[model samples]
Target chain A: MPGPKIGRRGALAAGLALPFIRPAIAQTAEPYVMGSLFPMSGPSAEFGEAFTRGAQVALQHIAADNLLRRPVRLQSEDSQALPQPSVVGMNKLISVDRAHWVLVSWTATSKAVAPIGDRAKTIMVNGGAVGPDLAGLSPYFWNVIALAHLEVQVMVPFLVRQRNARRVALIYVDDPLGDGILGQLRGTLPRHGGELVGSFSVPRAAQQFGPVVARVRQTRPDAVYVASFGAQNAQIVKALRDNGVTQTICSYSAFGIDSLRTMPEAEGALFTSQKLDLTGAHALTSRFATDFRARFGQPPLVYHANYYNAAYLFGLLAKQVETAGGTVNGDSLRAAMLATRKFDLVGGEGEFDEQGNMLTQMQVNEIRGQQFVAIG
Target chain B: MTAFLLNLATLAAISGILASTLNFIVGYAGIFSVAHAVFFGLGAYGGAQVALLLVPDPFLACFVAALIAGGLSLCLALPALRVRGEYFVAASLGLQMVAATLFAELKPLTGGIGGLVGIPRPEIFGTVVPVLPLALAALALILFLTARLQRGAFGRTLQSIRDADSAAEALGKNVNAAKTLAVAFACAGAGVAGALYALHLSFINVESFTLDQSIQIMAMVIIGGTGTLWGPLVGAIMLLSLPAVLSFIPFIPPTEVGAVQQIIYGLAMTLLMIFRPAGLVGDQTKGRSTS
Candidate 1:
């Protein structure tokens, strides 16, 4: 220990030689800046935090897989899921941060920023907003998840033909998500031989559904379909049951919300969700499930899976761009995406259409004794 | 960064016009209506319809929007302004709620919650005027007009009615007529502001005209100082810029910025009321009763 001790002059010499000894330290590639505009505060902050968590885990897997030699840096802007903050935050993300590729959520935020992103030629990958209008928003804008029309289109036949629920009542939220469902139903139900007997719309912020429930009950629908999200879906079900409506109530993936296992009102409800069949010998989804569970001590939700897939796709695309002797940017990445329209994701495999929109398989499932038992 | 600042400045300008008009009604006219955003909504929808259906002429759109909002102001003014202060506030609140519902439900006009999009930029003389410059010019015009209105006989009549309606009425001032006219004029300014807002954002929706938005506009007037020409403008700039300014501080954590902003706004509002009741830029020499 005494022999190893260095004086100030020796220490200075060693410090001076360090950079030359490890020259590659100075040659590391610059980090790729990935921008994520989300509701980092306000009512939707939980979803934002969860999306960030998925991305964090994705970085670990991206490194383990050696998808890209260069590191990726995630930059976030709090949109608060509103127009004003969304516009300002989007401009900051594009102009100041210089993140050519951004992940955006919320229907309003997507619509507000679509024209701006298109003007700047920024690649905005939306995985959360389900608005149908987002389908044809911009050439630069792409959707990684199924839009509302697809979900509702797939859901209607399952309710009508499979369940024999011809006369259906709808309780929908009055925002984009609900409007998306509403727009689709206008065409979908009549085509599927199902009639919409009663349709009730509650504001996005409506907490009390007594008047709505009373109206819906009066219609005496054979089944009730709730085009809603979060706690509202469960609240609507509870309101229907409390008002003595014995209708076969159902919804999309929202029926399997986190609190559904504990809520008796959500029992017997069927939903449509995308699930990867991890039955192969070395399935990527099975491995991801194991690793995600080991890391977070909980199974990943659909949102977590979606965000993880979004980040994982970026890594794959970056590798493709670099391999093709092009810089990884919005245009190059978008080109890579279009060239390879199909992707194998941890959630499931998907194929992007000519419109840069992807649709996942929606498997029907039912809740039996708080367990989500798949039907098909 | 410059573009970001420009975005914020455009927002501030739109908010400046809104706050200035609210200041006229609440501060000068002695009407504490909380439904100022309804007029703003009316103007926004009116202007949006005009620009989308007719031409993108900034002047024509704003003028039509202002006239529409001014006429509708009578609905709130005749019923609410003649009542007590608290009842006027309640009436304004109800108006905001009803207007929000109407904006959302009137699918043919307001786009049914998805909002009206693809609105072109302000075109003047067949040349497109940039949104930032247009917004700032509108704010200047509103402030100048407010100054002239607050200083002349119009201002005296409002002040006299505000100080004591009976005394003003005894002196042959038409209290109801003056109050109604003041509301219409103030609402017209709000309409112009709303038109600029629609043009600036290039999108309009019911969310922008909710009770929450009304409260924010009211807060701008109260925090800046009521009854003063520059008070609401200053408040608009300060409140709109608070989040950006806080991000520059080295000690504050990024996650705590929003919370810290709310805390600062609440504290500033409380301290201003207790120590400087007139507001940061409120007029103190007007002999206006504070209590």
Candidate 2:
């Protein structure tokens, strides 16, 4: 009777202890730290903040789900929106903090850091660097943001075939960033049977713009494509209106909308974005927006959606690697992350091509009254 | 290969030429017009504008732009140059700020904030002379001319004004003319450099030519040694190379390194002023009278 009783008690103890063992092993799992180099304090400070918020919300969502096999941490440093600062920030993130993966901010910063990242054997994901010069150039780099030139391919066809645009004028920011966009327009517009009537590049920090306004107005273009950002864009739009050059205008990114938010005169400007509209009919986006708003006290931008997706993708890759009996080496994680397809992450169907660029389509938007409305 | 060397030489030459002219005004003439960048910017815009509006040839544009810059410099000099010492400095700085603001706000004309870009490079006959060869030739010409000017009567008169403006005035020498000419020369050099910069980078934006750039150019003169013909070269090299060197070090973030490098530069300048006030090749007597 005593032998049977002792056997039964031992069996019960073994059953209870089995569930605790895996988590104990999992608890000891090594955390993989993701490093971010962004322009937190410089020219693109607002965009940087939006990116941080996006990445943060995503990471928080993954942690809440206990979807990560190991602890995940994100550390960030300011790049000041220049090449040298980016190189330094990337070094500290990799050498000091031992980050295996890096997400760099902006096209210029990414272009600057590509050589450094290649030398270090670390994977770099570019958030906003959208120049075609970077594409297919480096194997180590992955551009998550759709490049500006690619938009010309998408936008020109749509405008020529769909909107019946013929004569177009381009107003660019007169830098490397604008140069890339200009190259695209030059190549694509002619092929699309649309004529580029005039092109103008402006300098930054210029206090007045009467003469350029006069020149742009002289062209009398049917459509004006503006490639600029921040207060400079605001000033240009204001100058365009003040100088009486009123034509249908389109901008590349949320810059025009961001400009309109501050400048009442720029209320009807149109732009494009990668983030799903919170006000859209998509159930997932609506649900995410509700949750995000409740947590952060505002609607989420596309940058936040990207961050959530990156975090989710990172965790999923880590889990897959752990299951495959492979260690979370930089190369291994990068390969696994790249191989991801039809991944129903937080931002919708996630995909990455051979160039490490995200394949998600962008949405067109126009600012009406005080809000951004989906155009298509 | 020759083309590359020429372009490199041209950039150094232009910087040197600009530096030499600035040396006369700041080092020898003892007028630290912080608005020197504005003059430089004016030359760039003027050069590009003249080339775009009047002449298609970059070389001819260079001349027209220089004349425009020189003419503008005189206009700026009349009211601003009358003040002595700190007041002059304040007035010049104000001009720089106002000019930069005008360039941005007056968008209809200046392309507000997006600087003039794609201004054609200097061409010989039908051949588009490569930047390197053109720059090298330009550098040689600027250097030769600067060397000649330094040994000329104008140079001596400019030095006299720098040594003692009152004395120079008492000697019946036109002090204002000397100062204005020195400014015009500096403005011309800056214009040439700006035109080349527009061509070389194949881009020009307002961000590249800021009040901060004016400050940097001034630092080049001060750090390299005031009034010395070679001062700007050494200073430009130091300022440019220091950041380049700091960029190579790992473990330190570039931004942090940049901040630290600036701090060290400030300390170095302070020490330079304290111990070797004459700078690397500065004459103590000249320093007292001029600097």
Interface RMSD of each candidate, angstroms, one decimal: 7.4, 13.7
- What value does DockQ give for candidate 1? 0.19
Q: Tens digits of per-residue lDDT for model 2 on A246-353?
A: 776777664533436557657767666664767767765676677778877877766667655665566777777778889875677777876665466544565778
lDDT (10s digit) by residue, model 1, range B1-291: 677788889889999999999999888878988888899989988888888999998888899889999999998888654685788788878888888888888889888788888877789888988678877887899889888988999899999988887899999998888899889988998999888888877887787888988899988888789888899999899778765543333333333434454566568667666765666798655334657
Give the candidate number with the greatest lDDT.
Answer: 1
Instruction: Report RMSD for candidate 1.
Output: 7.3
TM-score of 2: 0.59
lDDT of 2 at A156: 75
lDDT for position A215 in model 2? 85
TM-score of chain A of each: 0.85, 0.84
Question: Can you write out model 1's per-residue Cα lDDT over A1-376, one digit (the tens) per residue?
Answer: 4577798899968745542432233236557767787777665666676666666677678888878878876666767777877787777767766675788887778888887788778888887777777887888888877776677777789888888888888899887778778777777999999988888889866778989999998888888889876567777888888888887887776564457645788788877666644444436677776777787786666666677777778888889998988988878988998899888887678788877887777677777787676776
Off by over 4 Å in 1: A1-30, A161-164, A175-180, A190-193, A254-256, A259-262, A276-282, A367-373, B246-277, B283-291
Q: Could you tell me how far off, in angstroms, the CA of residue B221 lies in candidate 2 after the best superposition?
A: 9.9
Docking class of 1: incorrect
lDDT of 2 by residue, B190-235 (tens): 7766665544433344544567777878877876788676767777
Interface RMSD of 2: 13.7
